[model samples]
Every structure is written in C-alpha cells, then in structure tokens.
Target: MKTRAITGFFFVVVMLGSFFAGAAVYSIFFGLLAIVCLQEFYGLLKKSGSSPNVATGLINGAYTYAAFAALFHWDVYPEAQTIHKLVFLLVPAMLAVFVQELYRNTDKPFQNIAYTFLGIIFTIVPFSFFHALGFVTNTGFSAHIPMGFLLMLWANDTGAYLVGRQFGRAKLFERHSPKKTWEGFIGGIIISAIAGYVLSIYFKELEWKQWVSMAIIISVIGTLGDLVESMFKRSINVKDSGGILPGHGGLLDRFDGLLLAAPMVFTYLYFIFN
Candidate 1:
C-alpha cells in the first residue's frame, strides 16, 4: 500500500510537471509515453501466443506520434495539403506491417499483423490525439485544456473507487470488469462534473458547460477504457499489464483510461469546442 501510494505520488508529480514544463516537454513526454505503452501492449500480445511485429510497430508508432506532434506543433489545419500529405505517410507505414509479416515463418502471420496494427491503433493514435489537445487551439500550446481534462479524469477515478468500495452493489459490466458498479459510475460522473465546474472557475479557456461535458466524457469513456484494458489483460490471462509502476501495474494500466478518453476529449475540443 505504501509503495503504491509513493509511486502514484511521484507519477502525478512527473505528469503535472511535464505539462507545466512547456510544450516541448509535453510533446516529448507523451510521444515517448506512446512508444513505451505500445511496447507493453505488444508484450502482452506476445504472452498470449501472438507474435506482434514489435520492431516495426515501435518504429511506426514513434513515427505516428511524431507526425501528430508535428501537425499539432505547427497548428496545421485539416484543409492544408501538408496535413493530407503528412497523413498519407501513414499508409506506407501501415502497409509495411504486412510486408514485415511476410518474412516471419510463424503460422499466425495475419494474427501477428493484426496485433501489430492494433498496438499502434490502441496505444499510439489516442496519444497523438492527446498531444493535439495541448495545441488544439491556435493559441499556441496552452496547458489549460489538457490539464483540466486530466484533473476531471482523476477526479472521476478517485470518486468511483471511493464510492464503489462503500456502496457499490449492482455490477456495471460483469463480463469485462466485475468490480465496477453502476453506483460507482454515477458517483464518478458527479464528482467529475464538480471538478469541471471548479476548473471553469480557474481555466476560463472553456466555459463551465464545456468543462462539464468534458468531465462526463472522461468519466463515461474513461471507465470504458479501463474495462477495455481489463478485457485485454483478462484475455491474456495476466493480472496486471506490467510492473513498471510498482504497485500501479504498468504504464498501460495507468493510462488505459487516458488512451480512450484522450481521443474522445480531443474530438470534442477539436470539432465542438473549436
């Protein structure tokens, strides 16, 4: 318990530090974070008898993140031709996954290819969207949105845990995550909405409604994200994703909610908020 608390404290400090350290640190931190998470994902697949193309996936995952980082850094709009071309570059990288599989003599060639791509899609793409969150506005890389989003997410997680341990009875989704309860889910949403309201008072970049909407998305989608990761782990017959974070399991476990929530939050901020 002490170890978990200690690791969690340092983890939060480093994460918040990365955000306030400037745009470069934020981009680099998440860019590298995507790569590390991809590796852990591939490791899990490998344990489940799927030989994912780790090298190719890692290289391409790094490339994918860097591409998004570049796009976000430059504030490139979708209508720009460079944006189209930059996105076009991913086609070849994705195709390379199939080509790399041709050389592997494993019987599960298609399975390997699928897992490789899944690792990228699961781990890299959402992080790319998260990276864009900091630069979603043309305001030149403000941390308000990203930081607010995280605060609300943490609020939801903490609220759910506390409430669920006390009053949780009805299962939320017994198939994927048995410990979760609808009571906890509602508790999370309420706490997250409160957190959003508080954030609106300080981070005036977004109105209270928008912040609350983001909180709800993070709570609902983020919980789904956790379930998805739990499903992945259960499929592999493993308890935790990894032991990198000591008691926190792994980077993938820690950021599973962020994985799914980041993209959804980014979409809301990009299309609706912007």
Candidate 2:
C-alpha cells in the first residue's frame, strides 16, 4: 500500500504538471507515454507467441502521434501547418508494415501485420483524441476539460475502491473483474458527481450540469474501459501488463480507463465547445 500510494502521488504530480506546464510539455509527455504503452502492448502480444513488427509499428506509432500533435496545434502555431502535412504520409507508413512482413517469410504474415496495426489503433488513436482534447476549442488550449476529466476519473476510482470494498455484494462483472460490484459502480458515480460539483466552482469552462455529466460519463464509461482492459489481460493469462510501476501494473494498467474514455470525453467536449 505504501508503494502504491507513493507511486500514485508522483503519477498525479507529473500528470498535473504536464497539464499546467504548457502545450509542448503536455504533447511531449503524452506522446512518449503513448509510444511506451504501445511498446508494452506489443510486448504482451509477442509473449503470446504472436510476432508483431515492433520496429515498423513503433515508427508508425511515433509518426502517427507526431502528426496528430501537430494537427492539434495547427491553430496556435504557424509551423504546425507544415508538421500537420505529415499526416498525409500516415497511410503509406502504415502500409510499410505489410511490405516489411512479406520479406520475413513467416506463415502468419497477415496476423503479424494485423497485430502491428492493432497496437497503433488500440493505443495511439485514443491518445491522439486525448491530445486533441487539450485543443478542443478554437479559442486556445484549455486544461479545464482534460484536467476535470482526470479528477473525475480518479474520484470514481477512489470511490469505487473504497465503497466496493465495504458495501459491495453484487458482482458487476464476475468474469473479467470479480471484485467490482454494482454497489461500487453506483458509489463511484455519486462520488464522481460530487467531484464534478466541486470542479465547477473553480473551472468555469463548463456549467455545473456539464461537469456532472462528464463525471457520469467518466465513471460509467471509464469503468467499461477498465473492464475491457481486464478482459484483454485475462485473455493473455497474465496477472499484470508489466512491472514498470512498482505497485501499479504497467502503463496500460494505469491508463486503461483513459484509453476508451478519452475519445468519448473529447467528443463530448468537441460538441460542447464547437
């Protein structure tokens, strides 16, 4: 518990720092995070006897993330226009994996290629949407939505963990996650709503109702995201994704909720802002 708490503290600090620092730091930090998570995911696949083209996949992942980052900054930075043009090359870069696989002479060439791209789709695409969330509005980069999103997510996680441990009786999903309970799920929503109410007092970007709505979205959908990731790990018969974090499992374990929830929250904010 001590290790987990200490690691969680630093994780929150670095995450909040990334948000407050500026767009460059935020972009770079998450860009690297996406790459690292992608690598971890590919590593998991390889352990399952599936050969993923790690080199091509990482290069394409990096290129894809950089392109998306540049596109997100198109409004604020002029040079972003040039960097944004790199997005057009994304298709060719992805296809290069297929060509590279052909020479490997492996029988499962398509399977290899599929998993290679799957890594990018599973990891990079959501992160790209997350990166876009920081630039959702035309006015400028605002951390209110993204930061609030994290606050509510953390709130739900805390609430569920505490409440589920105490009052949880009915299992939420016994197959993927046995500890989760319907009671905990409801508890998470309530606590996250309270967190939203508090956030409205400080961040005036969204109305209180909107804030609470986002909280519900995060609580419900983020839980689903957690379940999905759990399912993935269970399929592979692994206890944790990796041991990168001492108490925490891996990058994927830490950010699993964000994987699915980021895109949904970004869509919500995009419509609200635009």
Candidate 3:
C-alpha cells in the first residue's frame, strides 16, 4: 500500500506537470507512454500464444503518435471531422494486419492482431481528444483546459474509492470489476459534477450546464474504461499490464479512466462551443 501510494503521488506530480506544460510537451510525454503501453500490450498478445510482428507494433505506435500530432499540431481535417478521418485510417491498417496474419498462419493470428489493435485504439484515441482540446484556446484558457480535465478525473476516482469503501453495498458490475458498487458510482458522479461546476467558473468559455454534463459523462464512461482494461487483464490472466511504476502497475493501468474520459470531455467541449 505504501509503495502504491508513493507511486501514485509521483504519477500525479508528473501528470500535473504535463497538463500545465502545453500541447507539444504533453503530446511527446504521452506518445512515449503510448509506446510503452503498446509494448506491454504486445507482451500480453505473445502470452496468448500469438506473435504480432514487432515491426507492426512499432508501426501501430508510430501511427498513433502521428495521428495525435496531426490532430493537434496541424489541421489535417476540419475541427469537427478529425476523429472520423482517424477512424478511417484504422480500416486500412487493420486490413493490412489481417493480410499479414493470413501469411503467418500463427496461433490465433486474427484474434490476436485484432484485439491488439482494439486495445491500442481503446487506450490511445480518446487521449487524442485531450490533445485537440488543448488547441481550442481563448488565450488565457490554455493552461486551464488540461488541468481542469485532469482534476475532474482525479476527483471522480477519489470520490468513488472513498464512498465505495464506506457505504458500498450493491455491486456495479461484479464480473468485470468486483469492487465497484452502484452507490460509489453515483457518489463519484455527484462529486465530479461539483468539481466541474467549480471549474466552469474559471473557464470562461464553458457554461455550467456544459461542464456538469461533461462531469457526468466522465464519471460514467471513465468507469466503463476501467472495466474495459480489467476485461483485458482477465483475458490475458495478468494482474497488471507492467510493473513500470511501483504502485501504479503501468501507464495503461493509471490512465484507463482518462483514456475514455478525455474524448467525452473533448467532444462535449467541441460540439457545444464550436
């Protein structure tokens, strides 16, 4: 527990620094993290008795980093249409992987390649939304965007854990995540909403209604993200993705909720404001 707490603290500091630093810096930091996560994911795939080409893994990671950099640093697509184009890229890439699998004739080739792609998409795409959000600035609001989103996520997670430990009775999803309770989930939403309401006051561009809506979205979707990662772990028969961080397990373990939450928050901000 002490190790986990220390690691968690270190993670919070680094994330806070990255959030305040600006888009390019944050993108590079997270890009490296994405690469690490992809490597860990490939390890899991290998453990499943399927070997994805290491070069393919590198390609996937590069594509992900490029997609994010383009979305944020360049106007590759209209602001509203970026994600759709990103999705389009996936089809051709996955088709290429499928063709490669046919030639390899390895154990469970298709399923392994398919799930590996899914994991990457699931973990990386939503974060691109945050990267894009950093670009949607009203001058002074630049620093506020990432920090607000990070705080809201932190608040939600903290709220759920505290409340669940105290008064959790009914389970939320027993098979996917046994410790989560419906009560704690609701508590998390409420707490996060409160935090969002406070943040809205500072972010001049966003209305209170929009902020609260985002909070609700984050709480619910973030929980689902955790469950999704849990599902992956269960499938691979692992406790954590890696032991890179003493308490946090790996980049994936620490950011699972953010992976889902960031996209929802970004979409809400984009559609409502733009």
Candidate 4:
C-alpha cells in the first residue's frame, strides 16, 4: 500500500510536469512512453508464445512518433506534402518487420509479423494522437487541451472505482473485467460530467456544451479502453501489464484509458475545429 501511494505520487508529479512544461517536454515524455509501451506489449506477446519482431516495431514507432511530433510540435513541415513524405518512411519500415521475420525463423512467421504491426497500432498510434492533443487547437501547444481530456478520464476512473466498490452488484463484463459494474459505469459518467463542467469554467478554451460532450466521450470510450486492456491481460493470464510502476502495474495499465480515448477525442476535436 505504501509503495503504491509513493509510486502514484511521483507519477502524478511527472504527469503534471510533462503536461505544463511545454510542447517539447510533453513530446519527449510521451515519445519515450510510446517506446516503453511497445516493448511491454511485445513482452506480453512473447509470454503468449508469439515472437513479435519488437526491434523493428520499436524503431518504426520511434520514427513515426518523431515525424508526427515534428509535424505538430515544431511545425517543422510547412507543407502537407512534406509531412506526407516524412510519414511515407513508415511504409518501408513496416515492410522491414516482415523481412526481419524471415531471419527469425519462428514457426508462426505471419503471426509474429502481424503482432509486430498490432503492437504499433495498438500502442503507438493512440499515443501519437495524444501527442497531437497538445496542439489540438493550433494554440501553440498548451497543456489545457490535453489536460482537459485527461481530467475527465481521471474523473471517470475515480468515480467508477469508488462507486463500484460500494454499490457494485451487476457485472459490466464478467469475461474481460469482473470488477466493473453498470452502477459504477453510470457513476463514472455523472462524476465526469461534473468534472467537465468545472474544467470548462476555468479553462474557457472549450465551452460548456463542448466540455459536456467531451466528458461523455471520455466516460464511455475511456472505459472501453480500460476493458480492452483488461481483455489483453486476461488473454495472457497476467495480473498486471508490467512491474515498472510498482502499484501502478505498468505504463500500459496506467495509460490504458488513453489508448482508445485519445484517438476518439482527437477525431472529435478535429471535426469540431474543421
């Protein structure tokens, strides 16, 4: 218990610091996070009797993140064509994973290669969307954009845990996650909506209606993200994703809410802005 609290404290501190410190810091932090998460994902696959080409996956993810961050954070590419050129590197890098599989001589050659790409899609792509959140409004990379999204996510988690413990009876998904309950899910939505209202008052970047919609998205989609990760763990018969965070399980466990939420939220904000 003490270890969990200690680890959580430091985690929150680093989280806030990376968020507010500026775009460069946020990019560097999440870029590294993307790599670490890819490794851990491949670790899970390995335990399940699959040998994903982690090296190729990691390298590809790193460059993919770098290119996206360059385009968004630094505004390095003035032209959309140039950005496409940068992203085109992923084409060959992805193929390289298949090529590398030949030398690995794994019995499940296609499966290994497929898992390699899956790891990148599941872990890195969502994180890249999260990185884009910092610049969602073209406001020159403030924490407000991403922070608003994260606050709702955190609210949902807290509310769900608290309410689920006290009043949980019916199962939300007995197969993937036994602890979650419908009562808790509703509780999370109510609390997250309240949090979104509070955030709208102070942030002012998004109006009340927008914030409410965001809260709804976060509450529903974010919970799905959690369940999906839980499903992943259940498949591998693992308790936690990794032991890197002590009480937090692993980076993947802690940030699982962002996996599906990030991409959806990004799409929402994009549609709203455009």
Per-residue alpha-carbon lDDT of model 2 for 1-274, expressed as tens digits? 9999999899889999999998889889999999999999999998888999999999999999998888767777876557667789988998899899878977799999999999999899988888887888667788777888889999999999999999999999999999999999999999999999999999888899999998998999999999998998889888788888889989988888888889998888889987
Off by over 4 Å in 4: 74-84
Candidate 4, residues 171-225, lDDT tens digits: the string is 9998999899999999999999999999989998788889989999989999999
For lDDT, candidate 3 versus 4, the one ahead is: 4
How far in Å is the alpha carbon of 65 misplaced in model 4?
Answer: 1.3
Candidate 3 residue 269 Cα shift, in angstroms, is 1.7
Higher-TM-score candidate of 1 and 3: 1
Considering lDDT, which of the candidate structures 1 and 2 is the better prediction for this target?
A: 2
The collision pairs in model 1 are none
What are the per-model numbers of colliding residue pairs? 0, 0, 0, 0
- How many clashes show up in model 4? 0
Q: Model 1 scores what on Cα lDDT? A: 0.89
Model 2 misplaced stretches (Cα beyond 4 Å) = none
Residues 1-274, candidate 1, lDDT per residue (tens digit)?
Answer: 9999999999999999999898888999989888999999999988888899999999899988887787765553445546635766888988999998888899989988888889999999999888888887767889889888888989999999999999999999999898999999999999999999999999988889999999999999999999999999998898888889998888999888998999889888888645
User: 101-144, model 3: which lDDT tens digit per residue?
Assistant: 77785667767677667656765566566666666652322657
How far out, in Å, is residue 34 in model 3?
2.1
lDDT of model 2 at position 203: 88
TM-score of each: 0.94, 0.97, 0.84, 0.95
Ranking by lDDT: 2, 1, 4, 3
Candidate No. with top lDDT: 2
lDDT of 2: 0.90
